[model samples]
Target: MQRYFVPKEQFDESGVRITGEDARHIRRVMRMNVADTIICANNKGDAFLCKIKAFEDQSVIAGIESVLTSESELPVRITIAQGIPKGDKFDTIVQKGTECGAAAFIPFHSERTVSVWQKEKSEKKRLRLQRIAKEASEQTHRLLIPEVEPLMTLDQLLIFSERFTCKAVAYEETAKAGVQSGLPSLLRNMKAGNSLIMVIGPEGGLSPNEAERLKQSGFLLCGLGPRILRTETAALYLLSCASYHFELLQREVDR
Candidate 1:
């Protein structure tokens, strides 16, 4: 069955109203007609098996045959503060991060970050990234579309640390300290329902001063592994590790 996203306000006891572009997609793109069965998610974590009841001039009405809660979100909320990389890396980050179950994404301008975010260009890029996140969320069957915040400087991100319960930053130098000192351990130690903030640096990775500053500000410094990953690669690595550590493997451990 085809799947589509429906707004929360459009859902009720009667049915869901699919209109505008979505209606066009159903009527034209997907070519779904009246009496056709499809799935619709309201972004509030509710999935409904819907059957097309009426097709109006500009809208389509679908009767909810059944509803189920979306269970794809990670147990712990993870917010990734990634150092904006050059080229199409940011788009890839947004798409993959959403699929990996990141609750939110922040593009940071770290000391070693090569990409500069001017106001107009930054907005343009953020919008594009935001669209990618939305599409990825829908494709992955995620209830919430992780937000991509505007670009922030290193200082700004450090100051924003008060927003999360647990904060971790990926530092390559820290791996040499010990094996338990990696991202997997940090995520493993996180309790359910905890909100986490992970910081990933740019191409060259976090500078010594930046790492020191983060440590001084109460951020837990963790390593990925012995092999150093690129700026774009680091966020996905941490996200996948986080999902496995907090959502899958951890749950089995608890059982």
Candidate 2:
């Protein structure tokens, strides 16, 4: 079934009211007609099995047939704190990261990050990333739209890591085998509701002193694998590993 996400305000007491780009997509792109059954989700993870009642220029009204709680969210909430990379790689990061089920993203300024976000550029990039996140969320049928938070410094990221139940910083300087290291075990052992945070640095990677500070702040220094991965690649890789371990592995075990 085709799925669409609408804002919470679009849902009235009776059903959902689709307008703007969403209305255009349903009417013209999807070519949806009256009495057609489709899935309509509010931003908060409430999905309704809806049948179109009316289609018009300004709005498309649909009656709620049934509402189901969304099961698309991951068991472990994973947040990626990535050091802002140069060029348009951040777009790739936000899109793929959303698909991999990231809860939130933090683009931080690290020592070696080639791209600098001054006042105006920072807001522009933040807005651009946020729009990418929204599109990616709709494409993936995600219930909650992951946020592309404002840029932070390395120190800020370290401080923020304290909020997570499990926190790890990806550092190439850490003297350990990437996948074979304790990282896998640590991730696997996390309780179902635990929130995980993974930190990925820029092109040159996190500085030694920065890594040490993160470690001192209680973040495990883990390696991705023997071969080094790019900044954008690392964020997706970590989230994928986490989803496989926590969500897919448990589902397989239960069956």
Candidate 3:
């Protein structure tokens, strides 16, 4: 069944009303008619199996059939703080990162960052990324859409790291030095429901001064592996590892 995320106000005791782009998607794109079943999720991450009740005034009213209970999120909340890269790489990062269970994304400007987000274009770019995250979340059956934050400075990102239970920076120098246990050790100590922030630099990578600042701020400088990864690959790699450790591994242990 197709899934649509509706605002909390649109949902009543019995059903949900999807409007605007989603209604158009259901009416014109999906061609859903009355009685067609679809999944509707509210802002609070509650999902319901709903049957289309009516189409009225550019809206699709769906009656709740049943509540859905399934775990589609990772045990740990992982936020990706990436230095702005060139071109559409950030879009791909958000799309794939959502599928891999990233809780949020923070795009920041580091010393080596080449792509700058001017004030005029920030909102437009953020909106595009938000759309990508929503589509990816629905496709992946995620209960909540990953948040895409406005671009921040390196100092702001460091300050934001204080809110996370654990923090790490993907440093190529660490990989070159064959330091591989930092990430695994961090993961082992992390408990369920903890929040993590993983930082990745842009194409030119982080400057030495920035790395030192992050380390001073209590961000672990970890290696993804012995190989160096691109800015886009680093975030996905961390998310995949997190999912395997927190989701797939835990499932096997439970079984």
Candidate 4:
């Protein structure tokens, strides 16, 4: 079933009222009609099996059939603090990161970050990334949409790291030094429901001074294996490993 993330106000005793772009997508793009079933998730992260009850003025009124029990989210809440990469790489990161179960994304500017976010176009860029995260969430059947936060500076990123239970930085130098134990050790120490913030630098990667500052701010400098990954690949790699450790591997252990 097609899924749409509807705002809380859209739901009532009768059904859900989906309007704007989503309604257009359903009406024109998907060519859905009355009696068609779709999955609707509310602001509270609850998904319901809804049946289309009516369509009027580019709006879709879907009646709530039953609440869906979705367990697709990862046990751990992982946030990717990615240094703004060039071109459309951030878009790909947000989309794939959402599928890999990232809770949120924070794009920051590091010393080595080449892509500049002009003040004039920052909001527009952020909104585009947010849309990507939302669509990817729905497609992957995620209960809650992953957020794409506004771009921040290194100092701001440090403050943001305070909110996470664990913090780590993907450092190429660490990988070069054959330091492979940091990431696994951090994961082993973390439990379910823990929030983690993984930082990855942009194209040229973080400078030594920037890495030192992050380490001083309590971010672990870890390696994603011995190979050096691109700015976009590093974040995805961390998220994939987190899902395997906290969801797939844990389930096997429980069994």
Q: Give per-residue CA lDDT, model 4, range 182-249, as digits (tens).
A: 77789889988899998889999999999999999998888998888888898788888888887888
Displacement of the residue 90 alpha carbon in candidate 1, Å? 0.9
lDDT of 3: 0.90
lDDT of 2 at 106: 94
Off by over 4 Å in 1: 176-180
User: How far out, in Å, is residue 111 in model 4?
Assistant: 0.9
C-alpha displacement of 52 in model 1, angstroms? 1.7
Give the candidate order by descending lDDT.
3, 4, 2, 1
Please name the candidate that would achieve the greatest TM-score relative to the true structure. 3
Q: lDDT (0-100) at residue 156 of candidate 1?
A: 86
* Residue-level lDDT tens digits of model 2 in 1-255: 777788898898789888888788889889889999888888787888999999866789999998777667888888889888999999999999999999999999998988888977898989999889888887888888888889998777877778899888888765334345457887877887789888888999988888888889898888886767888898887888887887787789988
Write candidate 3's Cα lDDT for 142-228 as tens digits.
899999988899888878889999998889998878777477788888988899998899999989999999999998888997788
> Cα lDDT of model 4 overall?
0.89
Model 2 misplaced stretches (Cα beyond 4 Å): 175-179
Model 4 Cα shift for residue 224 (angstroms): 0.8
lDDT of each: 0.83, 0.85, 0.90, 0.89
**Candidate 4, superposed: residue stretches over 4 Å from native:** none
- Output the number of the lDDT-best candidate: 3
